[model samples]
Each structure stands twice: as structure tokens, then as C-alpha cells.
Target: MPLDELPPPKVELSDDDWRARLTPEEFAVLRRAGTERPGVGEYTNTHTEGVYTCRACGAELFRSTEKFDSHCGWPSFFDPSHSDAVILRPDDSLGMRRVEVLCASCHSHLGHVFSGEGYPTPTDQRYCINSISLRLVPAED
Candidate 1:
């Protein structure tokens, strides 16, 4: 779905400022690159039609149409809402090699994405995202 309005420009804030604006959990996931327990995210089983924006910066990231049940214990998207909405990077943390997904605007860690573990999506990729890293803005009726 197209965004209702343009994304509030790229966000740049200090650690203190970010901490002040987010809850502990949100801070962990968005700033500290922490992960929530599997299968316990708010958006994992959600079928609401809307756009998912960065919890910290309100930048549009994923759309409901891209969401699908990957049964991977997190919200999964076949692609981002826009190409420039997210930034991908190499993550070698936890002794595993993976591509990490981050909000392009705020550089907050959203999650990791994997490929070749196909689920019949157009992109042939699963953007495994954290629920706390996103805020759903339901579509208008």
C-alpha cells in the first residue's frame, strides 16, 4: 500500500534522545539490535491490513500485502514497502552469518533476511522482522 504521507525525513538522534523516546523493549530491538523471543511478536499472526512503520522513526517499511506466514516465529515479509525503506547489511553476530535489515532512516535493527528457503514469494526471500521494531498503521476503510 502507498504511504498516506511521505515518510517523516530520516531520523538522527543521540543515544540519550532515543532512550527517552522509546520503551525498554523497543530500545533493545531498535537500538541495541536485540531480538524478541520467537513466536511471541505482536505482528506474527496479525492479518490486519496496514503499513508497518519503524517503531522509533515512523518510516514506512513493510506493507500488509507483503506479509505471509513463514512460521519462522516472527513477522515475515516478501519485500519491503519500498526499495529505499530499508537497508541491508552483513551480520556475523552470534557466530552466524546473515544479512541484517535496518530502517533506512534511523538505522535501527529490524531483523535479518534470508533467501533460498523459498515460500513461493515473488522475491524468494523472507524478511524476518521483529514485532517490537514496527508499528502498524491500519488502512482506512
Candidate 2:
């Protein structure tokens, strides 16, 4: 679909404000479609209990209970906390086919989704997310 045909981003941020709030690296991934180095994300080896929210808008996206290791060099989740919190787009970049995931609230590029995978989780869906796109909030003890 054309760019105009797709739904508008759920959240908006001023470039100056966002820059002041995030580092250069964070801004690139969250706002400029940049990817982090493999196995470098704090959540990749994390097994803590928390909720992952959008870095740009702080909208809840995924829960810690749903997180799993997909070995895809990014944070993976079996499912999102809510359906309406995210939006999927057909990505044809890099001469490959992939389903792009975005935060419904801010339209920030979260990651991609793949199906029919062998995951230890009950759900066969894999939401391969970029760590830079999320902020983890620890669950209450």
C-alpha cells in the first residue's frame, strides 16, 4: 500500500524534544529506523518481570510474562499485551519479505512478526522486537 493509504502514526514527537530525551543511538532506532547490534540489547538476556512500553510515548506494548528468547538478536515476545496497541505493515525493504511491527500509539518502529515458529511459548507467533524501541518497567512485587 502507498504511504498515504496506511494509517497515520499513533504518536508524534518534536525532533528537538525527542533528541533531548533520547541519545543519538536511541533516536536513530526509535525515530529513524535504525537497528541495534546483535546480542547487545539489555533485554535480550533479561528474565526480569516487567512491562515493555513504547519509548516514545510510554504506551504499554508487551508484558514481561510474554517475553522469550528467539535468538534473533532482539527482544522477542509471544504476544503483545493488547491487540490495538500495535500495528503491522508489509515491509519490502532489503529485498526481502517481512511483517513490520510498530507501536500503535507513536508509530515508532518496534520490529517484525513471524509465524509458524518453534518457540517454547504456547503461542507460535514470534514478535521479534528491537530493544531500542522499548522501555521496560518492572512489575510490582
Best candidate, lDDT: 1
TM-score of 2: 0.90
| Model 1 TM-score on a 0 to 1 scale | 0.92
Which ranges in model 1 have alpha carbons more than 4 Å from their true place? 1-9
When summed lDDT is taken over every stretch of 10 residues in candidate 1, the lowest stretch is 1-10
- Write down the worst ten-residue block by lDDT for model 2: 1-10
**CA lDDT of every candidate:** 0.92, 0.85
TM-score of each: 0.92, 0.90
Q: lDDT value for candidate 2? A: 0.85
Q: What's the residue-level lDDT of 70 in candidate 2? A: 79
Overall local distance difference test of candidate 1: 0.92
State in Å the error of residue 135, model 2. Answer: 1.0
